[model samples]
Target: MKRIRSPQKTAEKLLLAVMTLFAAVASVIFLLPTVLTITNSFMAQSEINANYGVVFSSVSGGSKTFISEKVNLKFIPDIVSFSQYFSVLFKTPDYLLKFWNSVILTVPVVIFQTAVALFASYGFARLTGKLKEILFFFYIVLMLMPYQVTLVPNYLVADKLGLLNTRWAIILPGIFSPFAVFLLTKAMKRIPKTYFEAAMLDGASELQIFTNICFPMVRSAVFSVLMLVFIDYWNMVEQPLILLNDEQMHPLSIFLSKINTGDTGLAFAVAVIYMTPSLLMFLYGEEYLVEGITYSGGIKG
Candidate 1:
């Protein structure tokens, strides 16, 4: 039997369709420029300027004003080349070194930030005291604060501590993020208390309880934090510029800026190169993040 959908149900379905269409259109609009950049990177710079020729494109033979005459495209190159990519790596070896430097700097920051954040989250969920409340509140406030506000004080502190001009200058500070702790804590607190109580009654130590039960349960959250933090620092620029004055100590974020000054084409190529790690991580771990956010959000509410 065929039955017509009620007006309310029809309206709900229409709204969903409109929402989905909006999302897809928004995504395409955002992604279109990135796609163009990638495609244009494969093109030689001459081709990129071919459009300019289309406007001014005329063989000015002996100063005859001929807008009607079809001009041979002298500026238009016959071929697209990977010259930009080659220049980014070889002609300027700094691009390559900077690319690797970004990798070195970002990897450890993600690791330890995730490690400490997971434990902190567990603590927030499990522990009791006025101290925990105060500390967690402090973390949320700091995390929510602007990065620029913290930069000067952090630099001064690093200078005082003599950690300036070293990789540790950037890395050690990144290891102790408050946002990761806050988000994970929110996720972990959602886990049922009975699980922990049951584990304890069965003779598990606190350490054993965290490793066996808490970790597996909040796996989604930990993974999400790791991905987010990695991408955040991976694309950093301003921090290393302000804090680390030494040319060698400059992470790839600053290094990319230097290349940009030398060559625009090479700069875009570097952007394309530098984006791969974060892009791969995002694509791979999106499922984990979705599950983690849903789990974390619903765990308590």
Candidate 2:
């Protein structure tokens, strides 16, 4: 005889189905813009203009009226052209320069920030006292504060140090950001005290334990912090815009807005190039990122 399912089991199954459907829909919604950008980047300039002219025209024209025009959100172009890419990659030296500027400014921040966080986190993890707790609390507070709130202080400090209009203005602040410190400290603290005690008992110095034991255990978290910090600085626009006075020194993130004022198609092409580094980094480190975050939070995976 066929067995009947219980009402509770059926209800649970129904709930699961609903949740899955919601997740799928949300994923699509979130990914739609990225899909659109990648697809539109391949479209010919004429076609891009035809599809988006209504929206851009309104903005450029400085119209105060609400845009009632329906934009043609085409995922596929009638003709796929490489001209935009060709122009952005070859013809536009300025675009390439700005791209390099972004790389120059972002790379140092990622490298130094991770290095600083590693040592600082180690101290916070190993040391125990009211002072350590208080200091860690302050780091958390700084991390929690929105960047906007800290922008003025950064600006003032940069000016006082005569770092205004320089890459150092942005790099210095990012290098000392508290986000990585807080994350790494949490991850390090989760390591059992027995590991350190055993290492010490065996005549391992603090530096040796840090390098051989602590570093190995938290390697995934370090990778996670590197990727996260790289992505954060790579997309920075406000910092460069405010700090660097010379337009030529501004990163691609800032230049992207300027591209919109000119060739709208070029904006899409440049955006694809701009995001390529971040996308590649994320794809490569995705597994490490997830594992790091999981273990750091004391969650078993």
Candidate 3:
């Protein structure tokens, strides 16, 4: 049997098609930079210079401008080269060292902060009172405050503790992040109290209940926290810059910032490699992130 669509239904379908096409175009426009960075990483040195030499030259006091010269953007290389990748991986020992430094600096923050947030959020969810309300309000206020606002106080504390220039200067401040507490607390509140009551009736201790029940229930939120924390710390520039005086001790984020203007090919390669960890975490944790945020943002008692 064949069914004919009404004119109105056909018009609505055409509208949907147009909207989808518009969105696809918009997405491609937004993703262009990332796509170009990744593709340019494999470009031959000559091709890179041919494409971007004018811009870099302008930065170095040449007279080339976007309006002054014909701009050429390259997504595919005339001849793909792995020299940049090899240089970053083998020829540069410090790049690997700084990459590991980023790993060391980021992993502890993610683990400790998520653990601290989860436990603190569990306590806030279970206990209800005016004092708790006041404290939670403070947490929200602190979370709203900009990172730059706290940077000076944090530096003073680090200086006082003699942790300046050491990884502790970075780790300590990140471990007690307010945003984690706020996010995880919201997730925890969404959990019903009846679950806690049932667990208690079954003689489950607070630790047992937290470990056995609450943690599993909020696994997505935990993953969300880990992803967020990792990305935040992985791309950190200011903390390392302000806290660590020694360039050798800097993370890859700071290292990337110091990339030589002449080494554009190496810079692009490093950028791609540097972006991989956060990319992987985001891809894997994306579903958890969405679900966690949805639950956290919903109305709760």
Error of 1 at 286 (Å): 0.7
lDDT tens readout by residue for model 2, 203-246: 99999999999988898899999999998888887898788999
Instruction: TM-score each candidate.
Output: 0.84, 0.94, 0.90
Against the unseen true structure, what C-alpha lDDT does each candidate score? 0.78, 0.90, 0.88
Model 3: CA > 4 A from native: 1-15, 58-67, 297-301
Tell me, by lDDT, which candidate is best: 2
lDDT of candidate model 3 versus the reference:
0.88
Look at candidate 1 and tell me the lDDT of residue 47.
Answer: 65
**Model 3 lDDT per residue over 1-301, tens place:** 9998899999999999999999999999998988999999999878888888766654446343453677699898888899999998999888899999999999999999998998899899899899999999999999999889999999999999999999999999899988899998888788778889999999999999999988887888888888888999999989999999998889999888666455788889999999999888888878889987777633334
* Model 2 TM: 0.94
Candidate 1: where are CA atoms >4 Å away? 1-5, 51-80, 258-261, 297-301
Q: Write the per-residue lDDT of candidate 1 for residues 196-273, one digit (tens) a residue.
A: 999999999999999898888788888888888988998888777887787776667777655533455666577788
Badly placed stretches (over 4 Å) of model 2 are 58-67, 297-301
